[model samples]
Target chain A: MSITPEERLNVAMTINGRRYRAGVEARKTLADFIREDAQLPGTKLGCEHGVCGSCTVLLDDLPARSCLTLAVQAEGRQIRTVESLADGQELNTLQRAFREQHGLQCGFCTAGFLMTATALLEENPAPTREDIVETVSGSLCRCTGYETIVAAIEQAAADGAEGNDDAKDGAQ
Target chain B: MKPPKFSYVAPTTLDDALKHLASDPDAKVLSGGQSLMPLLAMRLAAPSILVDLQHVPNLSDIEDRGDHIRIGARVTHREIERSALLADRLPILSAAASHIAHPQIRSRGTFGGSTAHADPSGEWPTILLALSATMQAVGPHGNRTIEADDFFVGPFTSTLRDDEILTHVSIPTTRTAWSFQEAAVKKGDYGLALIAATGTPRGGVLVDPRVTVGAAVGSVTRLVAVERILTDEPLTDELAEEAAVAAAESVKPISDIHGSSDYRRKLVASLVRRAVVELKNGA
Candidate 1:
C-alpha cells in the first residue's frame, strides 16, 4: 500500500508586499507553486535542472534557485519573483537601464539576470565590472553576449549616482 | 520533465529521521538535491523514499570552536564561500569550493552532500582529503567518526550505510596550511584535472605533503610517490616538474569524451607543476 503525505499544508507567505495562502503539495516545486498557484509567470522555468538560472528568485531577500526548492519548504517565508521588480507602471532603474542599453533580445533570461543583479547591487552598490560578472555567472544569456547586460547594470549605477530617476523603496 | 514519482518525507527531528531511514530499506536522504535531483530525473536512481532533512534546523550553521571547524551537513556552499571563518581558518577549502559548479549551484548545494556523493571530479573529496578532515556518520548504530582516507571507497560510492545520514564534517584547525589548483574547460564544470596539497614548508623543504590528484581516474587517489619525493627532497623547479611527471604516470585513466587518458595524464602533470610552483611561490 502507498501512503501519501497529508495534502493540506497552509503555505502563508508575503510576496510583493501582499499576503497569500496556498494549499501546496509536499512535492510541488517552488517554481510551479509561484507560477501555477500564485499566477506569477515572470519567473521563467528553463532546463528545470539547476544549471539554467532562469528560475532564479529571492527567498527572504537572498537569491536562490527556486526550481530546486520545495514549495512546502518555503512556507511562512517571504518570496519575490521578477514580477515584483517594478511599481505598477514605472520601470525600476535596472529595467529602465536594460531598455536604454539594449541588454535584452528575446528576453527569456532577463528575469533571472535582473533578480540576480538586483541582489548584487543591493549588497554592494559600488560593485566593479568583475563583481558584476561573477555575480551573474550563475545566470546564462544566449543572446547579446552579456556586454549590453553588463553595460546596463553600469548604466543603472551611473544613473543612480546622477539621481536621474527615483529608486524603488525596497526589494520586490 | 519532473523527477520520477517517489514518496517523500520531511522529518521533524534527527531521531525521527533515523527511525524513518531504518524503517525503509530503500531510503535516500535528500540534502541540497543538486546531485540527487539530476539522478532522479534521469532515472538513474529511484529510491523508494526520499527522507528530506530541511526541517531539521540545526544542520545549517557554521560553528568555529578555535581548535577545529564543525560544518553542519546542510550548510550551503555559498555560506562557506562568504564566511570569514572559513576563509581565515581553512582558505584552501574556500579556494576549492569557489571552483565548485557555479554561484547558484554553490548557493543551493550543501558541503556534506558533495562529500557524501563522493564524486571524484567534485571539489569536496579532494579538499577534505588535503585537509585530512573527518566525517561523522549517523545511523541506527549512532554516530561514528570516519577519517577522510577511510570514508571514500570508490567512484560515486561512500562508506555510509543505507541508514546513515552524514551529519557533519570536522576539519582540524591546527597546522591547516594548504594550496589548490584546478584546470577546467569552462567557468563552472568539473575540473579537467586538479592537484591539491596541504602541509607546511619548513627550512626550504616541503613537509607533510598530502598530495592528491582529482578528475583523472574514475575515483580520486593519493600520489604517495610524489608525496615521498617532496618530503625527502627539497622542492625545486626541476624536482617539482619530475614529481608532476611521476604523479601523472601513477594514475590509470580511461579514455572518455571529456578527454583522452593520454590527454588527462599530460594535463595532470602540467597541473601538478603549476600547483607545486604555486607552493614554491608561497601559495
Candidate 2:
C-alpha cells in the first residue's frame, strides 16, 4: 500500500493593507500563517478551538477566530489585525480608551477585545452600554471582570460620536 | 491542538464535491467550519480529505417560497437570525436562532452544518424538528430527502452517508402560533432540555399541537402524551400544569456534568408549562 501525499495549497491574502503569498500545508491555520508566514504576531491564539476568542481577527471586516480558519481559506480575503488599528504612531480611539480606562490587565486578551470592539463600533458608532457588553462578550478577559473593558468601548463609541469615527476605514 | 494533516479540495460545484466524496470515502464536508474545525483541532474527527464547499453556488441562498422556505446549505446562523423573512414567517425559529452559540460562532456556523452535525442538544435540530423540516442531500448516486425525525440518529450522528452531502433544508410554511423554551447553563451553551410547541389557534384554543423536547438522552423526542392532553383540554393553568407533568414523566433524560436526569425532567416540566402559557397568551 502506498500513502498519498498531502497537497500544499497556495494562499494569497491581504493583511493590514499588505499582501502576502505563501504555500501552506492544508492543515495550516490562519493564525499560524499570520504569525509566521506574514510575520505579524499581533494575532494571538489562546485556544486552537473556537471556544476562546483571543485569536479573533477581522476576516473580510467580520470577526473570525483565525485559529479555527485554515490559511487556504483566506485566499483572496481581506484580514485586519491589531496592527492595522494604529496610524503610523497614533493609537486609535479604542486603544486610547483602553489605556485611559485601564481596560486591560495582563494585555494578553487586549487585541481580541480591541478587534471585536472595532468591528462593533464601526458598524454601530452610538451603541448603548448593553450593546457594548454584548459586542465584547465573545472575547474573554479573566482580569478586570470586563467592567473596565466595557466602559472603554462605551467611551470610545461616545468619543467617536463627535465625528472622529475613523475606525471604519481601518476595518476595511 | 491543531488539525491533523489532510488534503484539501475546494469544489465549486455540487457534482464535483460529490465526486470527490465518492472517490474518497474518508473525505469530510466542510461548510463554514465553525463546528467541524473545532472537532478537527480537538482530534475528535480526523478525516483524510476535507471537501471545502465555500465556492459551491446556491448553497448560501435563503429563498422565500410561497409556502415554504428553501434554505441553502451554506446559510450562516447569523444570517438566519437577522433574516426578516424568517422573523416574519418563522418567528419561532428566528427567536430560537438567538440561542445558538454567541455571535462569533453564529457568524461562521452554517444552518446546514449545524443540522448535519446533529448534536442531540443542538438548537437547530430541535427547532427544525419542531417545524417538521426536511433534509435535502445529494450523493454520487442521486439526491434524497429525509424528514427531520429520520435524520438525527444519536449524539453527533446523522443519517447522512459518507458519500453524501447535505445540500439544503426545506422548512414548510409555519403560519402557526409557536413557543420555544429551554434551560442552558450559559447564554450559548447547549440546553439541558429544550421544548417547543407548534400549533394553530382554532376556536379559541391552540390546536394541532406538536411539542418536541431536545437534549433528553440522545435525540429530540416529541411529547405525544402531553400534546394529547393539551389538544383534548381547553387552555388553562390547570391543563398546562397537567401537560407539564406528563411531559416531565414521558422523557428519559440522562445525567451529564451539566445536569442530572431528574434535574432535566424538572426542566422539561417547567419549560413545557412556560411555553404552553406563552403560546396560550398569544393565541
Number of the top TM-score candidate: 2
| Candidate 2, B6-114: lDDT as tens digits | 8788888899888888877688898889888988899999888888898889898888898899999899988998899888888887898888877777878899999
lDDT of 1 by residue, A1-172 (tens): 1224544456766665566788765556788888888889999988886777888887777778788777766777777788887767878888999999999999999999888887777667777998878778888899989999999988877766321112223423
Give the interface RMSD of each candidate.
3.6, 4.6
- What TM-score would every model get versus the actual structure? 0.93, 0.95
lDDT of 1 by residue, B1-283 (tens): 5666566777889988898788879888888888887676567787777788888768888889788899999998888888898899888877777788866677778998999999989888887887788999888878899998998889988898889999999988754546688888876777888788876667777667788877887877788887877784666799879878888878777578899999988888887787777777773
Worst 10 residues of 1 chain B by lDDT: B172-181
- Could you give the CAPRI-style class of model 1? acceptable
Best by lDDT: 2
Clashing pairs in 2: none
Pick the DockQ winner.
Answer: 2
